[model samples]
Target: ERHRDMRRASSSLLGLAPRLLSGPRLCSRPLPLLAFARASQQRSGDAALALGEIRVADATGSLGVMTPKQALALAAERKLHLVEVAPNASPPVWKLLATLPVVEKRPEPPKIEEM
Candidate 1:
């Protein structure tokens, strides 16, 4: 009598067929890839000269003082971009170029002093 009651309860629970104790399950819809990117992009604006007084340099590397707007106008006149090369200077240094600068690889130091 006791064993038969336990069998009935076990069969009733198996009929539920829920995946709580089972393996993984897939979602109904996939998540967007650029959801966070689109949200944060509007906050930072452009990566180039976007704020404060900036020091600009032309192709010849001649430095000059100007507001950010003036620097941008000069960049637009030459169909180039105003990229910030050095941001830690007294007033940040910017350059006019068609595109971003390429980073060159540095050579390794000598190993003579090593043990």
Candidate 2:
């Protein structure tokens, strides 16, 4: 009786698996494509800067629209990184972010003492 119940449950789960796999996903893009897009973005800081013009903002509030060069200059002056917050906006939105540092840090090689 116990074995029969387990078999029934397993069969039901197997039947539901197909539906679950075919159902609408939370994200429109597939998992692998999403991962690839994220990886590409991380690999290049200029991904957002590639745009002609963007809406820049800071800690206080919006800084208005400006060229990528100008935004980058402003961010450099404040020791912050110019990061894209919204890519879908009309001009795309960029913000001066000091919190998230995107620079890569490489570890120093070990040194050996001479005899």
lDDT of each: 0.60, 0.66
Q: Any runs in candidate 2 off by more than 4 Å, and if so which?
A: 1-45, 101-115
Best by TM-score: 2
The residue ranges of model 1 lying beyond 4 angstroms of the native Cα positions read 1-50, 102-115
Per-residue lDDT for 1-115 in model 1, tens only? 9855764566477663323323243462223333222323221114544567878887888569888888777777888877766667778777786865444467888778766
Worst 10 residues of 1 by lDDT: 36-45
Alpha-carbon shift of residue 91 in model 2 (angstroms)? 0.4
lDDT of 2 by residue, 1-115 (tens): 9955764576587664433343345553212233223423532236656778889888899999988888877877899877666677889887787866444558889999899
